[model samples]
Each structure stands twice: as structure tokens, then as C-alpha cells.
Target: MRKRLQTKLSATLPPEQLKKIYNSFDIVGDIAIIKTATPNLENAETAANQIMVIHKNVKTVFAQSSPIKGDFRVRQLNLLAGENKTITLYKENGCQFRVDVEKCYFSPRLSHERARIADLVESGEVVVNMFAGVGCFSVIIAKKVSQTKVYSIDVNPTAFEYMQQNVKVNRVYGNVVPLLGDAKEVIQTKLQGIADRVLMPLPEKALEYLPYAIMALKPEGGWIHFYDFQHATREENPVEKTKTQVAQKLACIGTDYRFASSRVVRSTGPNWWQTVLDIQVSGKPSKF
Candidate 1:
């Protein structure tokens, strides 16, 4: 179905425009997924304007500028919010995350999503964000989940430094540990015991980490937040595809698990969906 939709879209949209739209909405897991509409790519400004119309929830838009010698370089712009206020986001509710667009890799969508997740985390629980981008998830969780200990891991040094700063600024350094390295390597060598909740937000490649996520589960039970995208058929449900992926990965490691709950966290585009599957390992559920 996704392929069919893509074929139809390809006929109507310019190749460059189609590519841009695809890349724009190809939301990386661990980041926020925002809904976007098809844009008329004939005019660059018009296409951008169309995006602005449907994406009312987002106060910022990253626009593509001309490249070197008139090529295109994507640029971020602050959007207008209602009457007198320009959309400005501050580290709210003890969240110490700040994005240095000049030096740091940042995503407005991810930042907003982290804030939302932070609001949902409970105290005294252990949370691990596998792809902790700049500690956005880690800091927010630490700030909100006072009793919870968060281990945020990332392979990028620049991102790790910013994450450390965020933890300190939020005054949750005691609760959040900024680990600098790949999650695959760190999880095996450094982390022990099962986590109350594990966040696998790297949608593009999250399936590959399912085994590790299951292995890190807290014996009796724990929740794994799995995010990814898959092709769906008319008879196929996106949620079910995600479940199958999880199950297959677990089987690869000879582990069994059950879905506690599942829901579409957000939709990115036509046929392309971002779903989160909350799973509990087989057996009695543990009290976290």
C-alpha cells in the first residue's frame, strides 16, 4: 500500500520536491513525529507556505535554503504564534534542555516530544533512553520522575556534552546519568539488572535492538517502548507489523514477550506511521 501511494505521489510531485518531502517526514525514532501535508513543489515559497498551514502545532519550521553557489541548505526559522508572541520554548518544569543550532544537532519535534514523555513518566521508576539525543528524554524524565533514575546514552560526543549540561542545568544530575557511547556497546558492558522502562526511539533501526531491549528487561516484567516504520497492506495493521517485528527479534534471542498495550503515538505521512508498542516480558508482571 505504501508503495502504491508513493507511486501515485511520484506522478504528481516533482522528483526533488518528493525527495524533500520524504526526507522531511522520515522522522528518526527517539524524535518527535509531526503530521505534514503534501506540498505544491512548483514554487519553493509556496510549498513552504503550504507546510506552515497544516503544521499549526509546530511553532518552528526548518526550511531549505540555497546550497553553495545557489544550492540548497536547510535552515531553521521561528514561526509566528497567535497574536504578539513568536513561538519560543524554554526548559519548562525543571527540564534543562537547550539547543545550540549552530553547534549542536537539534530537532524541534523531538524536543517537544521529550517534554510530553517527561510529563507521563512516574517517580521511582528506572528509565533508559537508548538513543538519548542531547539528553532531551533523559533530562526531562529525571526532572519529572524525581524518584526515577535515568541512563541516557548516545554515541555522539557533542550531543553527550550537551546532555551533561542539560542534566546539570535541570539540577537532576543526581537522577540522570549521561553515558557517552553506542547503546549496543554500553548496554552490554555497563548496564545491569532490568529497567522499569526502556525507550527505543530510533525508529529507522529500532528493530535491531529488540533483543538487547528484551535482555535488559527486569525479569518478572518491564515495558519496552518500540518505535519504527513499516510497509502496511490493506489487510495489514501497522500496529500488528510492529508487534511481529518485536516478536521476531525476541525469537532471535530465544525470548518471549507480550504486548501490554499499543498505540499510534503519531503519524508522519500517508502510509508512513510512527507507532509505539509497550510490551511486557512473559510471566508475572513485576511491581516497579
Candidate 2:
């Protein structure tokens, strides 16, 4: 998609600025969002306009002017062209989600990851998603696997509202339970020891809430889909470092665990990567 957009943008932007356009852009429904540094803003505007022209489906174009930040993980957007609206319906894995881009956090990049985790779920397993932004992961799992029950919790009220709406939109209300408030508190009061699987997709707070995720799992222990951000040079392995830390933490919590798998989900920055570890935990420890 970037290649196609760039090919069309080349006609409007200078040769030197061609490569300046970031390779990554997001198309959430009818909106096209591009990230352009200050130096490349001019070219990005042209590209945004060109994008709408090339892709008739794109009715709006916005440049991501700031990094994803804040408790809600919303980014600052600069309108480049077309419609002023930010609300759209994003479809993924045969489920539909209505989202306000400026109010909630939804990433098309994680679509594959969501589906991957859903596929790993057994039919009767229960899942607790600590940072269930719009319940994308929860809804997908419920929609894909009929017997699974997912308790999706989010701190952001706007996200929670959208999550509830999405539950109805996708007809997964019976499968996914959307809750508003802090995940840690929710887990402590209502969700402890009920999950066969726990999802910690919020890397920013995943480590701090690690204990809660562990507590949510059954006494027999189960699976945890853990996400975290790690920085490493070319010589170091981020996944290994993360696994070691998590293993140490697990041992401290008296949970026997093994890293079933690990992979880089995306490059967050230079030498910084977002990684996921699929951990299998047992009630007692044994030497792996």
C-alpha cells in the first residue's frame, strides 16, 4: 500500500523528498493516516491529497503529527485533505468495530496478531484482556471461537463505551464482557483466578500489572500473552532479555512457567522493538 501510494505521490513531490515519506501509513476504514516529520510535512500533504485521488475509498487524509501518547493512547492528527470526520468502522477477522480515531486507540497493524492469538485459544478457555482497547482482541476471539468467554477491561471510558458498542455491533455480547475502569482493580475484585488465558497488550503498564495478570489465571495456571517494549543493540537479543526478566518475576510469584514462543511485533524506534511472549504457566516450578 505504501509502495502504491508512493508511486502516485512521486508525481507531486520532489525527487529528494520521495524517500523522506515514511513507509508506514494506516488506513482505518475510509481514513488514510500518514506520519511525516516536520521536514517532510509539505510532501506529506501532497501525498495525502494524492492518496485520496488514487484510492477512491479513502475519503479523508490525516497526518499523524505526534506520537501515540496519553492514557488513552490517542495521537495528535493534522488534517491534510478531505473529510474532517474521525469516526469510522474498521473491519477485521470478520468482525466490525466502530471507532473514533481521535478518542480511542486502534491499530490495524495488530490485526494479524489478534487473529493469531484467537487461533491459539481452546474452545472452552476463558480470556481476560487487561487493555482491551475497543475489545478488538476480545471480540475477535469470541467471534472466531464460539465457546470462549473473554472479559475485556479498559481504563479509558471512551474506549470502554466503544467496546460495548462493538460487542453489540459484532453480536458477541454473550461471548465478550466489556468492563470500564482500571484493569488491576477489575481483576482484583471480579476477575481473579478465573482466566485460562490473560492478555497484556499494554506494554506501557504490562510489567507493573504482571502480578494481576498472574492472579487472574486459574490455580492450575494457564497462558499469558505478554507484550513489552525492549531496547537492544545489534549484538543483544531483546526477546531473551524480556524472557529472562519475566521468568525471574514468575519464579518470584511462585508460578512455574516457560516461554512457549516469542516474536517481535514491530519496531517502535531505532534499536527499540515491541515484542510478545507466549508464556505457559504451571502451578509449580520445574527446571526447564
- Candidate that scores best on lDDT: 2
Worst window of 10 by summed lDDT in candidate 2: 279-288
Itemize residue pairs with steric clashes in candidate 1.
29-201, 29-203, 30-201, 66-71, 67-71, 67-72, 124-147
Report the CA-based lDDT of candidate 1 relative to the real structure: 0.61
Q: What is the lDDT for 274 in model 1?
A: 75
lDDT of 1 at 260: 77
Runs in model 2 lying further than 4 Å from the true structure: 14-16, 20-22, 284-288
> TM-score of each candidate?
0.67, 0.94
Q: Candidate 1: which stretches are off by over 4 Å?
A: 1-96, 101-105, 110-120, 233-235, 282-288
lDDT of 2 by residue, 1-288 (tens): 667877887777786677655455688999988865553767777888888877889999998888899988999888889989999999999999999998899899898899999999989899999999999999999998978899999998999999999999999877999999999899999998899999999998887888899889987889999999999999999888788888777777677777899999988767999899999988733321
